[model samples]
Target: MATVILLRHGRTEANASGTLAGRTAGVHLDDLGRTQATRAGDRLAVVPLAELVSSPLERCKETARVVAARQARHDSVRPRVHSDKGLTECDYGEWQGRKLRELARSALWKTVQTNPSAATFPGGESLPQMQARAVDAVRRRDAAVGSAHGSDAVWLAVSHGDVIKSVIADALGMHLDLFQRIQVDPASISVIRYTDARPYVLATNSHEGDLSWLAPKHRRKRTRSRADQDAPVGGGAGPGTPA
Candidate 1:
């Protein structure tokens, strides 16, 4: 078992303007976004993260870099940013750069809002596929971290808002249609603990906290499995997989 810290990338110009950036390239964080990410990094600087995984999108990559830089300040080995396409922003297709207010008037908007499980973007992926990949990505990374670092390992996944919400829905055993109720804001922190029995949703959309308490406790001396002792300290193509 391990804890996966899901972080939404900071706000972008599209966010401030209420536009859907989707997977459009070159969308970087705004000034406020930078500040928000910096504060998030400072908040989690003391936590011992086993790995830093991020969406390949520029916004997520930038946020991951800031968090990793802060973690590097306290740890002997600097954390590396592992890109995962599975965590990328949902492909909004024709709505990639549309304003939300304008899109809200479209007939498809209602379906997206009320029944996301049945919604599919024109020329893009279906909602179910998006949720599937995002959930799988997080679960795969959680298992990898637990196997390599042990049950108490804490890791991070920097991704988009909808993707985080979908993963949160899965962790809570909620249906995809109801995932819309979970609002993930810019630079928010959501935590999920996966154990042998089930997943625990520790926190969601959290903007404030020391987070140092997430550090694994100092364990009493005990015999560890040979596999655990022989696990690689560090080595991987990336922390998570793509769809």
Candidate 2:
């Protein structure tokens, strides 16, 4: 099992303006977004991350860089950043660059809110498909990291709000339609660990908190008990000692 620290990219100009900038080009984080990213990076600086992954989108890449820099400040084993398209923002298609207020008026908006599993953006992807891809991407990455760095490894993924929310919903074992109940704000951190039994979500949408405890602790050596040391050499009653 390896832990994934899933983070949403910092707010962009479109995000502040309440627009759906889905798949839009050249949408970088705004000034406040930069500050938010820095704060998020600070929160996670103490964690010994094995990898830093991001959506290829500019906002996510920028946020990932900030987190990587903060982590590298003290940790000598700085992780290289990797990009995955499956972690990209939801394809809003015609809704791209549209205001949320206006989009909320559309009939599809109700579907998105009330029954996301049935919501499909025109000329784009369905909500279910989006969730599937995002979840798959995370699982694939987690497996790869676990194999490479061992079960205790910690990794980071910088993605979009919807993408992270969908992944969290899956981790929580919630249905696609219920995923709308999960909120993922910009620069927020969420955590999920894939175990042999099931996925465990340790945190979600955390804006501020102490994450230093997540850093790997040195394993303490086991001390031998007095009885064990005195009673036996290699078991088998130890030369007629108490059976």
Candidate 3:
């Protein structure tokens, strides 16, 4: 088995503003978003990463660059950055630029909320379609990684919130309908250790801000290493959280 870490890109203007980015071009990371991504990179830098990859989208690319640099194996990991479109965010189609609340009021959006598993936005893809694409991207990447190297290789993949969640859900053998429970925040970390048998979650929602519950001590001290604090809990190398 291998280990895979799925990182969600940091927030964007569209994300902070609550707009549906939906495959928009040039929608780069905002200032706070960049800092957040950088901090996440700092957090991940201390860990040993075998490989790193990312979605082709600008946000994810930028985020991955920060993380790869932090890992100090940028050169080693750069060549592995496969620009897979399958990891792209959900295509909001015509509603790409619309606000979430505005879209929520639309009849189609309502349908989506009511039946996200089956609803498809006009001129866009459905949840199942997105899940399928995500599974393909994730599985193919892992298979390639396994084929290229032996077991014990740990890889990091930076992608969109929904994309990472879909991939994790697939790894868990959960239905697309269950994705709602898997919350991926900006620059959040989700881990799956692939063993000879199956993949398993090492951590999820490993982001800053409100993840204190995952590590109450990290929240209290705010200075102690998460690794020192949470290692006993997760039973892993350390708190795979971003430093």
Taking the tens digit of each residue's C-alpha lDDT, what string does model 1 give over 1-243? 688999999999989999999999999999999999999998888888889999999999999999998888877557999999999999989988999999999999999999999999998888899999998989988888888887878899999999999999999999999999998999999999887667878799999977877777645322235433342356423223221
Error of 1 at 138 (Å): 0.7
- Misplaced by over 4 Å in model 3 are 73-80, 208-243
Q: Would you list the rank order by TM-score, best first?
A: 1, 2, 3
TM-score of each: 0.89, 0.88, 0.80
lDDT of 2 by residue, 169-226 (tens): 9888999889878989999999987776678777988999888766644333222233
Decreasing lDDT order of the candidates: 1, 2, 3
- Candidate 3, residue 31: the lDDT equals 93
C-alpha lDDT values of all predictions: 0.88, 0.86, 0.72
Off by over 4 Å in 1: 219-243
Better of 1 and 3 by TM-score: 1
- Most TM-score-accurate candidate: 1
Please report how far candidate 1 places residue 151 from its true position, in Å: 0.6
Model 3, 1-243: lDDT tens digits are 356778898889999999889788898899988998888876776555556777788999999888877767533443345677778888867888889988877887755654568778788888789888887877777766655554445678888877777778777888777777788999888877655456667688787533222222222212223333232554655434454
Pick the winner on lDDT between candidates 2 and 3: 2
Candidate 3 TM-score, true structure as reference:
0.80
